[model samples]
Target chain A: MSSQSVVFKPEISKPLLQEVMDRSGQNVLACYQCRRCAAGCPVGDETGVTPDRLIRMILLGEKNEAFNNLLVWKCVACYTCGTRCPNNIQTARINEILKQMSKEAHIEPLNPKVAAFHNAFLTSASHFGRVNELEFMSLYEIQNTRSELKRGGGWRAIVDKIKDRAKLGISMMKKKRLHFKLDKIKGLSEIKRLYAKAREKSVDR
Target chain B: MEIAYYPGCSLHASSELYDIQSRMVFRRMGVELKEIEDWNCCGATSAGKTDDFLAIALPARNLGIADASGLAEIVIPCSSCYSRMIVSQKKLADDPGLKNTINAELIKKAEGKIKISSILEVLVSKANSGEIAEKSIKNLEGIKPACYYGCLLTRFPCDVEIPDSVENPQGMEIVCKIIGAQPIDWSYKTDCCGASAVINDTDTSLLLMSRILHDAVARGANCFVTTCPMCQLNMDAYQEQVGEKYGIQKRLPVYFITELLGIAMGFSPNEMQLDRHFIDPFGLLTELKLI
Candidate 1:
């Protein structure tokens, strides 16, 4: 915590705040720095970024600082914070919008695996019109392995990961939760078009 | 009562027991579930992070299909799916421009605005009206269950409108009482079980799950009754993992709320697929003489 007396700048760009409010339908300005959001957050203790702090950063126009924080990715999207907010700020929704903005700005998340999992999930859904759990896990593992190797962890890290998943994977397979074949929902073309249109619109934004 | 059923991806695959027990319980209650044709994934927590439009569009597509089915209401078994569907409906209702764009993009019209409901909501209403109590054949007086709501079921007060108090929900408790089981009060009832984090960040996810389990155990809960499949999977399948990590020997079995309801309704263990859980619940059922 900074002990220095805080100075408020008179002329601050509020584009990020405006965009967040506009996109999330949350009243970013209504937040009064009440720590109720942080108090109710389930993962608040695990991360350095609290819901109040994130809202404060946004209010202070620290868009880059707030967007770069790993807390954005760490949020479980549980909405505990939102439900507890006195002003109904919807802090979880703000975090989500920030996450999307971070991706749009091509900012690599501090937690790569979370982003990787999201990418793998969307990829699977877009292709099959539904999630194929087996395929999704495989793609996520492949991405993780590639990134690990690039970071110079080599085959040891890959082997370790496989070993970690081996027991659970076998159990899931035995229970018939995991499958060998890909399951595709009908009307793949419609889903493909939706994905294409979303991509096009996101790019336009 | 007849309603459109949206099982989502998890129900069709990983969480098939939830689907089975849900159908069985509802069937016994004379509620007919018409499965939504060509329903896709709700995108869970992934789509919103990857793409905003797809997040809303995926669930909206299902809502459109459900509306077209002539059903005025849709019953969603998974809390996550319920949240996504409700949120999507609210988003479309709030933003006509976005809804228009999505409709144009998908080339399908969303008509008649179908209502989305969670399985808990449906069951609790029946229990409140004495419908469940009338149907329940087996008494579960010996079972002490900690009803777990997780996050999605009662969060976002403005959007996901659960009938019970969001902070201290009683939907599951109502059903528990109707079936003659004791519902214990415990903290972390609405806490996140770290959902997908169970796959990506095992250590943190285990820690969250362990805390919830420890709390329920401290409150003298014999087992967990949950509405969400993700919560069941994390708490039930990972019970052994958490026990090993925390050096605790207590293995509390977790069951879907519908599974327990089925048991009370005189459905056999085989009918509910109770044997398929990672932690075998047979011992617990036997102790209560419910099998």
Candidate 2:
């Protein structure tokens, strides 16, 4: 028994692990402490929490830690972890579930810009059956700037952001990459129904 | 034959060059691309992260359109849209209950009979048939390209079948080879470019992209060829920023796979809209005397 590392199974609360498993459809229990996911994660060093460690948090019923990690916000859904995992456990899906859980749990998002951009994207997708790139980016800019202001970011920061984005936008426009003409989808009512259905179903959860 | 084409949001504007070059090149290869009638966004990484049902329902709506149109197959250029479409296509096909639940809100009901193809897969098949090789007016023997697949081109849900090796993709290489371009086999072929976070988390995205660029450039790749609009934009539009952060002086041009194929097919830089890229995709071509 002394020859191998031992796992001290702390008294585990069933809710956190069960909820994540249910929502994400990933078998977090299948993780055997192999750090294959850790080595492959592009942002693991930056996030300070690798896929294996995050799974350990869930299995250990560390609800707050599971929902609040930077991995939950910064994961780009690269699928590298799932590709390399021996058990095929996808942390990207788990991160998505945790992001929603954090929002519902009233834990402030560690990365508000991601949240704001997501909201802007959905709002644009809902407004018109398709995403108007011009509308969505403008929406993201407004919400992101406001959030930064709320966080006490100085006007200087906002000005710098505007200058940076303006330069980027102008370059894109010069190349005819910016769509000045809006192209909305024809099935507008159908898209609205889908959004309404999603909201109604999500509330029931 | 007429093939259904789904451009998604990025293709309409930000990746217009890809759209233009694609139309031009496919026409040259004797294939007609008919745009899908008023397709919606696939929700991409944003929609799925925002709502699971929208992720499926959004793409399903388009699949429904294609299937209903009797276009047995549809081709997508963007990797993000292709992955979303194929993954959702597989999920809705396998689970009847989930399909029924999502279908109730749709104007067009998805029958789950349509096949989805990425533009890279389409080109590779054409290259194999000798159609693409026949159109090559100039031998692209001089340029060396790093075929960057990024994330979603070949990686999907575990159950879905991918056309190429997920770890080491050769679809771009296969097509480039047909046109006489030597494609570099690099380590960062499947690396994630921090695509969705390119804007919200700019620093992290740049760091990830820097690693990818570093490896490709180290391997002596002159330019990057990708099928994903997001990957191309991140590397092409923001390589200057990536250079500043990583202190790398070398600026490698990024081009769409279709654009590179267009170059070999005797289309000029202006015809291919090579100037649309921030890094000047034509610079390496002109320097190498390929064009």
Candidate 3:
């Protein structure tokens, strides 16, 4: 892949590089350019870089390429590559650390379709403190710019929504008879307390 | 012995069977579940994916709340919640700055200190499997179940040491065996079934679930058992979806490990909420003559 394909600049500072090396056991540089990690990865073909390429970029301090590649994000952390690695290198953990770094880097827009699930997940958690599958799906549909039914006169989307609504309605009805007792959660107050503490620390920093 | 329990959001709502069966089984085993009151979501995958603090705060808040409740170890049943709680606890525990920041919130919230542990750990380390086996009134006998860990159970193996090897977890299998069910060995035990992603994106979720189910069925597993509510929900709720989407006509039943244990312990279907499953588990239990 061309270096120009990356939309953002690299943040390969010495400290970041040191951190990666520290977590990866200095084995990131030990990769002899073997394609085994790439070959062993089931989803390698779908991402831009193979597991080997991802590690190489990190080893070379190409933080931008290492962080932005779909290879790091798409890895289900199945540990297949890590388990199969001849060097006993933990590729899955390394991939996750890189993904974390990528998030912190504030990369630009991903595919609009891909963003649907992420948005739904965040909206659900931000509001309910838990995932609401029905709400998440509905919100995703709306964000996709697709109505309850797909455009072009197809009724599939409408049917899906109708079915979804019925199920959701039934679920809510059943839930009403049960006592949720949300008040019993002891950590809510403490978490709020912790949040305030965190804010104060940030301000102090 | 009394212990702290974190019944994740699903257990209180969609996957109520897990909560019901867990409570019953724990009671039967003479274990006390001191529920952590007013606990929030664990942020699962969403909070972390969107914003680090959002995800961190979700689990961190719950952990702090559990801590304030004065529990030494929080026993979580849901794999997603379990992983997030333990990981977030470790993160906060290791980072003094983060802990100090959260502790300020703890001071305001009036909750005490807490540590996180999965129910697997609690049952294995504290409950004593020998006692559980001795308490078993009935055996699972001929039922062959696929022991599924999904993705979240042991993602960060360092934080927790579940009974089996993280790479090849056998805790549930041991529990299943003690109850008389045969644990089918398969490569997909730790594989990802795409978790909550299935509800939002059918394509990805189906593909992943199909792979898992296909592997289990191919290996002659009569039913699939798991420790996570989300995994159970996905596997059970989307059976028809996966079949229709993939053109497979067979029915694959999924059960929470607790439900099977509850059944083996001579609990009735009503006690385990077996009637509420999307894919009926009674047929399998009846076929095994455990009903």
Please list, in the order the candidates appear, how each scores on TM-score for chain B only: 0.97, 0.97, 0.92
Candidate 1 docks at the CAPRI level of medium
The local distance difference test score of each candidate is: 0.84, 0.86, 0.67
Among all windows of 10 consecutive residues in model 1 chain B, the one with the lowest summed lDDT is B103-112
**lDDT value for model 1:** 0.84
Residue range A1-205, candidate 2, lDDT tens digits? 4586535455664788888889878888899989998999999989999999999888878878887889989898888898889998988889888887787667889899999989899899888877888899999999989989988999998999989999989988887778877878889888888888888878887
Give model 1's TM-score versus the native structure: 0.96
Clashes of each: 0, 0, 20
Better of 2 and 3 by DockQ: 2
For candidate 1, give the lDDT of residue B27. Answer: 89
Clashing pairs in 1: none
Error of 3 at B222 (Å): 0.5
Poorest 10 consecutive residues of model 1 chain A by lDDT?
Answer: A4-13
Candidate 2 chain B has its poorest 10 consecutive residues by lDDT at B154-163
Which candidate ranks first by DockQ, i.e. highest?
A: 2
- Give one digit per residue, the lDDT tens place, for model 1 in A99-163: 88888888877777888889899888887888888888889999988777776787976798799
Across residues A61-164, which tens digit of lDDT does each residue of candidate 3 receive? 77677666776656555556765566756676676565545444556423334445566665654455555555655677666645223335357655665587
Q: Return the clash pairs for model 2, or none.
A: none
DockQ of each: 0.64, 0.70, 0.29
